[model samples]
Target: MTNFDPAALPAAAFEPISELGPLSRERIKTRLDARGYNYAIDSDGDIGGRWDDHIFYFLLLGKDSEYLQVRGRWSRTLPASSLGQLLVLANEWNAGRIWPKAYVRTEENETLGVYCEHSVDYEPGLTDAQLDQHLGCAISTSLAFFSSLDEQFPEAVAAAKEEIARLTAEQQ
Candidate 1:
């Protein structure tokens, strides 16, 4: 059996919703608005955007777990947008389906504000037999998704890696 040390892992960093920038935030808001979603932005830096029937919250962390929530229930299922796609890709990476290689890039045309790409890799302690059964289930689900969406999965994974790389480069 492999000895696992969760403590050796690095702490997860919280990415501020504001880091997406006003323009990006506005774009998301506008999209939801056009879809007839009810949302509001307050002085406290909280943004709640909703469409269909789902609501998601984006909050700014403070003394309280400040966050902004955007929620909506979809009348019909919808394809995941760029952001949604990235999120799924990130989840897959975290689950060990894909390597955690990603970078961010900004286009000169300004049409695409920021983009990312990610590679695939096998994660240790993630697939151990002794690991939680739920974890195995989650990873299996992710793998099944990638298997079913063969073509799209590679593209999405690549984009995730690119986005991560771009973000890292920008910091330097």
Candidate 2:
């Protein structure tokens, strides 16, 4: 087995974070603020804000990595029993949308909520227009998913439970 060396990779494949990450963060903050979002910079240096009652946040997950992730959370907790239905919704939504992937998460107490996330990568670095487009996609997609789940989850969960019951009864 030969050792793999990233140094052998083309310099064009990587961009320095010092010039990109901080600038991008500042630009994102400035843009979001300009849009009238009141955000807080968290302890891990992530940005958190709210839009239309849903909480949204952004994080630069790595120093050398070009990925910037934005996430939005629904305001309501999903009942634990509805998690399977949430996964089904996420899977269905993911198949149709390329950005702001959907998810369901449970806390220690078993309260669950739906979330949507999108990761933007700057390889050679992004132009201001591209950055704006990516940010817009993130915010728009996240809100779209959040709105879908908020409006539809209860009925979907009921339908899922009914289907599960029917399947179980048929098996019996």
Candidate 3:
């Protein structure tokens, strides 16, 4: 037998998943793949991908995988000294927006890590359109929050601009 490489297959090669019901890892993978997003499945089976430098994970959690969560970690970290600033930013985002529940956590490295999550129970299952809306809203809202960070903490994220510019130039 030959070594099977899943990555070699075309996006269209995956089985058409028209009959959507419950939210499962495969459904998430199919949606991501169909949308041409680059993602990876971890050893624990969590599906994750990067967008504009931020990292997001699509997960189904529960005894029957009855819950769907799209969690994101902001790419920037601030010194613990900026805890107040981080908290204010998180609170502002939370107050103004609804899709992502944004917050900041004190990391072991003496820095503050930002996170955003959108989760819902899918006990009754979901249609493909519903899944698409959830996934799209999760990502777009999270990115909007990240962009707000870039705006509010420009000094902390200045390097991100340069790096993104470099990446964009390289793509051209």
Please identify model 1 stretches exceeding 4 Å from their true place.
1-131
Consecutive 10-residue window with the lowest summed lDDT within model 1: 69-78
The sequence of per-residue lDDT tens digits that candidate 3 reaches over residues 1-172 is 9899998999888765565487889888888888999999899989999998899999888889999999999988788998998889889888987779998998888988899999999997888888988999999999999888888888778766677889999999
Per-model TM values vs. the true structure: 0.23, 0.71, 0.80
| Descending-TM-score candidate ranking | 3, 2, 1
Worst 10 residues of 3 by lDDT: 13-22
What tens-digit string does per-residue lDDT give for candidate 1 at 59-105? Answer: 33323332222221111121334545545654555576442222222
What are the RMSD figures for all models against the true structure? 18.8, 11.1, 13.7
Give the per-residue Cα lDDT of candidate 2 at 145.
83
Model 1 alpha-carbon miss at residue 7, Å: 47
- Candidate 3: regions farther than 4 A off: 1-20, 159-172
Deviation (Å) of 23 in candidate 3: 1.1
**Candidate with best TM-score:** 3
Clashes of 1: 47
Candidate 3: the clashing residue pairs are none
Off by over 4 Å in 2: 1-23, 154-172
lDDT of each: 0.38, 0.76, 0.88
